[model samples]
Target: MIQQYGSGEPVRLFTAGLHGDEWETTSRLLEQLSPPRTGTLLLMPKVSDNEYLSTLDRDYYTTYAPHLLRAIKTYRPTIYLELHSYSKESYAALTGDGRFERYGVPAYIDIEAGILMGSVSPRIRKDFFTPNDLCVSFEMPKGPNEQSLSVICSLLDVVKECWSRQGFVAYMSRHYPQQTAVAVKNYLRFYGHLY
Candidate 1:
């Protein structure tokens, strides 16, 4: 259910398979990850087998996965990265510049990495982690691909190297100014804080 690797502060939690349909792809991505050299990496390859529970729906997860809730409270992760998938049809809506957005937060397309990333809302963060913790979700197009896999690995490296809130923000701000802003706004809008 939950596998932990490495050790120390700034614990990072990676979860996949909150929804049954997307579990296969998400879990595969999780499998590719190696343990971090520093800090703890908590991997939950399958959060729930019930196709009904979704991270987007707060009540579904809260009601169906008490064990997950327990794990979060027990571990107190510094960063929670939820892996999910999207349909090809919805790709434009996610990455488009139009006002219509599926996730409420601005999504960015890393053309070279072939991944779409957005911040999970503060509502979800509040339910699972402290206000200062970083919570984000990465969506791929319904399958495991090399580019996305590499990007996810790179993310873990960043988390391991920059294991503090301030350090992580500085890294993002220096390299990914736009995405950093979107993430900050997404967190701040809903009683989320980074201190």
Candidate 2:
């Protein structure tokens, strides 16, 4: 587990490697682990094991949901950052972090096109996916690509500016129509805060 510095406040749960193959997120989040910032932070470098990692399709919890769920139940974080690398692009790409409404944060902003949203669903429980908290599936940063770091940072900056008010499921349901509120609510009930 990785933490920042601080306590008694909203916490951010930064994670990577729901799919074992996406290794960059693991490296980045690992570097971020320090103490707790504000309330508490639980960082899991690789929630899924190598066995599942080698597979083509993977589920966040079913594959490695137990470990990740345990952590979430133990610590109810304010923000969940699901980081991963895009597989479609070998070098360059950019995807809009679309959302259901323009309230503030984009539902699924893309940090890097080359990254994929390997399986982050199982990590979130029903309660956390409420109106207050938000989840961002960040595309891993590209060292050099069609999209510059500055551009990605700007998008992230915008999300950061609005994250306090937006909800993750609302934003996602827009672009991914299948991501209904009902499904989100149901998923949370089954997989959320696994203490």
Candidate 3:
């Protein structure tokens, strides 16, 4: 269900559970739902609730792509964060250049040229990102462990702070010291090894 919270400008939209088994990510996104200190927060625990409830994996577009579009259009969020997880093969696709160790990080924020949606068109990507706006996804590793929960919590907290404050790069670096140097420029993307 989509729960609307908070008030004012800079509306924030967070979605999780496009995939049926993504309980951890869905729960984490729900936990972050609070009346924002300085803006609005729109939380969608499962965009495709039927798929999630059935516990049967299906493509997101087949079920409820309209719900996702409505959430974006209604909120017009200044920051849009989609929560997802990565399998071994999918993880390798991004870090295959050998710069990042395999499964080294708990979560990541993919902004550029990464597939965040299950089966949406390219036009939908524009909903999550716009110039001078924050658009990113929190990627968890396959079968999230205990550390995964902590990572999701911390990242969401940091994202909340960044929404209200300026120069959050230093704050983020202090919390996740293993951050890459390029994180400052592309602060929207946060991960343990890759930026």
Candidate 4:
């Protein structure tokens, strides 16, 4: 289901629970969110009922939950934040010594917050939303824990602050230069344009 709060431009959409098993923590996080000070916040706490939609495959969402896809298209959010979780065992694969390093997963460790932040790759974003829209995905270690919840909350605050002042892409490009460059290059290489 979707719950909307606040109003105006730069509509931000937050979706969790695309995979049934990983829904709990993200759903709880979305449930506790307060109304934004400016612009609209569209929260979809549960996006799918299929446990098998376990991967970040856009096709699964399009096929299984067409209504959710329809909702996203209709809303046309300026920022789409998709929340998900990974098992503790899988966390190693995503970090320093793992797939992130070898495969360039477009993820970074937020030194100040002590959490890993993952942004949608340009290739994936091309399939899901316009280049101008910022699409991010945060994958917490599975289960409910204080640190994970706090990190997400802090990230939310950062997202809001950046959106209000300098815009998400600008702020991200300033701080996360490498990831931003990779995203831009990938977008340009594959799509032949940034906008």
Tens digit per residue, CA lDDT, model 1, 1-195: 899888887788888777767787778667767888788899998888785554556565467777777787899888888777777786877677562254454444442355677666444565666656777677776764777777766765676555766777788788778777766664465443343
**Model with the higher lDDT, candidate 2 or 3:** 3
The backbone clash count of each candidate, in order, is 0, 21, 0, 0
Candidate 3, residue 17: lDDT: 74
On TM-score, who's better, 2 or 3? 3
| Top lDDT prediction, candidate number | 1
Ranking by TM-score: 1, 4, 3, 2
Clash pairs, candidate 4, are none
lDDT tens digits, residues 4-84, model 3? 777777777777775566655465556655566776777877665344432112334434466776767767777777676
TM-score of 2: 0.53
Cα distance off (Å), candidate 4, residue 6 = 1.7
Model 2, 37-139: lDDT tens digits are 2355556766654643422234545454557666666677666666555454532223332322322222333323333232234325344455356655655
Instruction: Give me the displacement of residue 86 in model 1, in angstroms.
Output: 1.3
Go through the candidates in order and give each one's C-alpha lDDT: 0.69, 0.47, 0.54, 0.66
Q: Which stretches of candidate 2 lie over 4 Å from their true place?
A: 29-37, 52-59, 89-128, 141-163, 166-195
Q: Model 1: residues >4 Å from true position, as ranges? A: 93-112, 190-195
Pick out the ten consecutive residues of candidate 3 with the lowest summed lDDT. 113-122
Worst 10 residues of 1 by lDDT: 99-108
Worst 10-residue lDDT window for candidate 2 reads 97-106
Write model 4 residue lDDT over 8-113, tens digit each, in one string: 7778888878777777666877887888877888889888757555344546656766766777778877688877777767665654535445664543443223
Residue 100 C-alpha lDDT in model 2: 24
- Give the deviation of candidate 2 from the true structure as CA RMSD: 8.8
